[model samples]
Target: MARQPALSASLQPTLGAHRRLMAGLIPEAGFHAAPLDGVTFMRADANTTPAPVLQEPSIVLLGQGLKRSYLDGEVLAYAPGEILVVALPMQFDCDTVVQPGQPMLALSVRIDMAVVAELACQMDPLPPLPPGAPSAHARGLSVAPMDAALADALTRLLEVLGDAEASRVLGPQLLRELHYRVLQGPAGTGLRALAASQGRLGRVFRSIEQMRADPARELSVAALARDAGMSVSAFHEAFKRVTGHAPLQYLKLTRLHLARSWMLDHDLGAAEAAYRVGYGSASQFSREFKRLFGLPPSAARSQPVVPA
Candidate 1:
């Protein structure tokens, strides 16, 4: 018989210390030389309160204490040995319960669908997608345990980031290794579905990319359907099936999200931010911004963004 797999142990303090150091390296709200294009580290000390912000496609790993992410009326919690995978864009709030001395530290890796697909191609085939496999709606998020192997791999990757030349040379390889580990976990199938070509999730991703490229361009269901190579009705059904929202609604959300980020990162005024995101009317942009985020553009920008 195959030797029984060893039981995973509690997350040790050493990992926490490494995470603390990694958190110190991340710059505030700007790009830095991260090991991967989509990875960022976070450090916070608090309990129950979270800074509100929009979620993106990424994986969050807690190396110390516990935290919670709320979206779509659902509250998802993760502790030291667990991972959270978020595949769609949405408004989310998260906070930690770790106090002053022992703060909550976490790492986030943005998922690149292209990389995920390539890794899937190289791996052994997974059990065929379940009959009526899980839908790929905008509500695409999952939480699962962080195994020892994965934890160690993440720790090593962070350490590599401390060395400038080594990070430049081997960063991409280590990032791929991290993706492979996620593909081997329970969230694997969910990620594989998103990366699959011609699948509903994949089609949605392509459509979203198109919208992002030209948000101001008028988007019609029929036009998108033609581009997706599906009938209008089929496209509508599949779009909703994969994203939990109608195609038009999805586009609007995308526009608003980009607008918010623009205002926050570029210090753009309401009118300018609106115009940049393809909105012609400043009032219209403000109204939508207030509706989605519970604050108008100027006020929202003044609020603190949750750290990466």
Candidate 2:
């Protein structure tokens, strides 16, 4: 059976310790790596402006506060006890809602395809894909209400991650349980398709992986399509169906995301960051960068937070 949150929908089963555990784990307002592998704890003291950011495959759960993500003219607003799952790397605009006294606390669990593949094989019959999720291979992100089973697993996982011995012993099992529960969710179909790695979505995913592997490469859409064993138009349609963005647009956004990371995480200058990401002309790079991130590269260099 699928999991549900502990308390009433709005309360999120804070029954006792989850919020307290997060408080002890997170010391300040920033994204913090946890003791357990593949898990991160996040806290934000103030509201964050909407900005385009790159999100890799992971499970994001809001424990306190609300977050709204914008994509393709649609708005996805999720509050506490709600979870968002992404099957692949994507760039989207995210805005965190928080107040001064009441901060936002969140958790991020990175997806492991190896574990997903193993689980997909073990289950006698895979969970049914939601009707809204088309083609049994559409890949992107989905938000759903957290049920009791998942909420219990997450609470236990947090408790286990708090202690050294418990984290070493039980963390893996709890982590696996969380992923298992998600596999039965609205987003399961895409994840299963990604795990199978043989269908059209699998082929499209490989091309995306190529872009992620080396955004600096001047990859042609035709070449990517050929490698996927599909014609250009077919590949284009399939790619958009799954990832929301067209092939070249996805590549450009990937390059811009890489440049932003270089500037913020590595302190690279504007021109250098653009050049590293395959931008030949600094002027053109700057123009495109601003158009996507809404700020110049220089601003990223000084930005203190990578929002949770």
Maximum-lDDT candidate: 2
Q: On a 0 to 100 scale, what is the lDDT of residue 307 in model 2?
A: 49
Tell me the tens digit of each residue's lDDT in model 1 across 1-308.
11112335455654565566666665342334365567776766555466555677878876566777765467677776677877655445666677566666677888877888898888786665568766433346677776766777787778777777877788778878888888888866667767765366667667877888898888899989988888999989877755556889878877887887887778877888788778888888889988877778889656656642
After superposition, the stretches of candidate 1 with alpha carbons farther than 4 Å from their true spots are 1-7, 10-37, 48-52, 88-91, 130-139, 229-244
Ten contiguous residues minimizing lDDT sum, candidate 1: 1-10
lDDT tens string, model 2, 71-186? 77777777667788888887678888876576778889999999999998887555565776656446576777777677778889888877879988899888899999888765
lDDT score, candidate 1: 0.71
Best by TM-score: 2
Q: Model 2 reaches what TM-score against the true structure?
A: 0.88
Off by over 4 Å in 2: 1-17, 127-133, 198-200, 304-308
